[model samples]
Target: MSGRVMPGHTSDLLTLQDAGALWAGLTADSAVPTASTILISSLGSAQMSYALLGSHVVMAVKAHDGRWSISESEVRRAAVGLRAVKVDPQDLVRIGPFGGMPKGEHSEAVLLGWRRRIVGELQRPDPPEQVVPDGDDRALHLAGIDWRRILTEQSRDRTRQTWWLPRAVVRLLDAAEHVERRWLQAGQKESKAAEGIRPRSPRSQTHTTENLQVTKPDHLAASLRPYNEELKGLLYSVLSRKPDTSRKVTGWICTLCRKVPATVLDHCHEHGYVRAPLCQSCNAQERPDHLYPNDIRVTDRYTRLLTTHATEWLRHWHRCPGCRTRTTLPLSHLAAWTAYVACRPLRPTHRDNHSSRGRKPCGTLRVAWTGSHHTPHTCQLTVTIDLCPSGEHRDLAKVPYRQATEQFRIWLAKTAPTVAAAAGPDRLDDLPAQFRPVIPDKSDKGLGLF
Candidate 1:
């Protein structure tokens, strides 16, 4: 009676509420219900096992493994199938996220609740900085205070300049946008409130309107002055350039991107420091080459912008080394060529290992080449080359892959200058010897000779 609680013979106890209550009473003495005490009910070939574990009743349906496993909501369904009343198990259940958090509940509050509120404040026109009315303001105030407190914890680290510069840069950018919106909204509210105030006299109505029209919240600007200063200091420290001149230009946005407020001066790396203001997004595109946090550079910020233009060119046409015809090339070849032009190393591939949760398994890179066809009727030959971090391929320095790739890409670009450039000739007589066929003919049918 104390260990496993099997349902007794009773015609009226078919409902889930009756079954749950009976199981609870029977297992009152037992902390955990065992398989021996669990009553199995069959719905066709599948069997449902109900166990009252301490205060909550847990149920498991027979899986293909011939074992019962517990899930969050399936037990309720199992109880219903056995003709029991619907018993909600949510109160007695403890639900959690996938990975365990080491910093405990406070970390969860910051990460889940506090971060979400900040994100919502940034994305929407919600007036977060304004004082809330009585009961309505309590939750918002608490959330705002918690978020600010978490950020303040990071401020001590922000005082020093080091490898954390990129993180600080990102945080500053986010804070700048949030504070700018809040300041603007506060100013707008002040202007609206000023308009609501009764004029001193009918004769002074025009004067009141004029004053209200120009009622810019200098006080709000004064209060948010630190955010503006912090943004400038962080930009100057991390990017090694002055704060974007746009900050001086009222209501400035990126001339090129048109999406975000222009925050950084986009210095043309190829054009000897010629600069223009651009949004962070456009700047990212201009310098698509991602550097490790510590490897941030001033010049590489503009490489990807050029690379994008080159890629758009490659998408339309590439001259075939074999036939000397302008044709669409594979995307992989185009990407490889772009990487070569940008002097970017190939990105490595990752394979997930579920067996070991903590360790990251080794990765591999595969390079595939499609061989030239002698005739269109014959199948084109493809060779797949696998490169791994082992033995001779361990360092990747032994192969000179980067150098060879650069040389080959340069040769192709020059040979297909018609595709890569607007001014280059369509036909080149000085192609590399290996690229030239054994014999060349004017006829299209016999383009290549053995």
Candidate 2:
């Protein structure tokens, strides 16, 4: 249903159902969680903040980047007054921040079930996330290191960061060109000044690149490709730990950020090219080098960067849905207006990004599974006709698993030849495409979302 404009807030509109749910949630719970979509400015820089009503406001899906301001009222009159005169969800802030409902289309019962879940959670709040797990004792510990927060998505509660690879706990597999630049420049300085201290390299997992070597806490140790093998395995363990979560080793800095503890082992997925240690944020935005062919556009920096690959691995892994003859999603996203219709269930998640496109989302990510979270999953959904983000007809829903894979195969056959024809057979710079990694039989269970 189309939204009806609320009387007081000129910029905001509330759909009838959303208003009803907000009213019900507030009246019953005696509190309503703040919408991260709504924001108020302040002088302070705290990430977890709360503030009073202000004219300058916006909404969003905040990672650990912003503070949360949940408003609560003592007067019983405020709740009854809201029912008489409509109020937007933002008015109820002061209790806690909420990321809205579970995604995907569901029957009314599912909505009811989640509402109940919300009530149960509010009645008895979740325990503090800082409790240390067993077997985590260390002679030396990094102060303020919360393994649970580091391993999980600190952005929004729902972003779901950790995934399981065959041999690693993969929180992220992304790029950090800017950070890398800063790191390399710093290494050059370290190399020049510390020439007197040069010695044989302490053994590392990946090959250590720089000539100068030093002991713990040196910025170059974590940045170098080869790392100490024994520490490397222990280093990798921090990302994968769920129940027995442990704090990071002392002086192991993130290779990318140069600040914060390194939790992820940033390795190449296809080649198993183990890179250096990275904090969660530093590696969140890089396209894995193995995804595409090195081309003319890349040779000359005129073409747009491969930012999309770092954002959505599955989209590139399975290949983008069709947009007539094209695969680039921007082409598909634009094509949606003319060639596709929006699905009600696939509506974008709400956020007030101070723009008209606040409700926009790229596409949903899905994984097909057979047993439970404990068991391995197998499937063949390679591609689909959903070239546009608005098109909900993914490979899984539109075609049989085998047929979808075949269609993908056919597309690859046609596309690869076309690319080769353009590049010419003699071109030496182009790299072969990297296939998705193989899953091992006894791998750690990834997040259910993965």
Which candidate leads in TM-score? 1
The RMSD of every model to the true structure, in order and in angstroms, is: 25.3, 21.1
lDDT of 1 by residue, 1-450 (tens): 111122221222234434434443443333222111233322122212333222122323334446543432333332222222122211111111112222122211111222233333333444679665643322222211212222221122245311111222222233334333433344356446646885345335323222322111112233322212222212212343335433442244443533334444433221112234444434434432212211122223223333545543332223222222223232233223333342234333344465555433233322222323122122221212234444333322122333443454565565556554532335444433332222211111111000
Worst lDDT run of 10 residues, candidate 2, spans 294-303
lDDT of each: 0.30, 0.27
How much does candidate 1 score in TM-score?
0.27
lDDT of 2 by residue, 1-450 (tens): 001111223233333234323434554432222121222222222211211111001111122333232222211222342223232321111111123323332221111122223323333433689555553311011110111221211222355322211101111111112222233344455545446566424332112222222221123335434323333212222333443322332134555445445544444333222345444444433221111121000111101112222222222221211211222222112112111221223333445477686764334322221222111123222222323345645532322333433343343345444432222224322223332242221111210101
Clashing pairs in 1: 4-37, 14-83, 15-84, 15-85, 16-84, 16-85, 17-85, 287-301
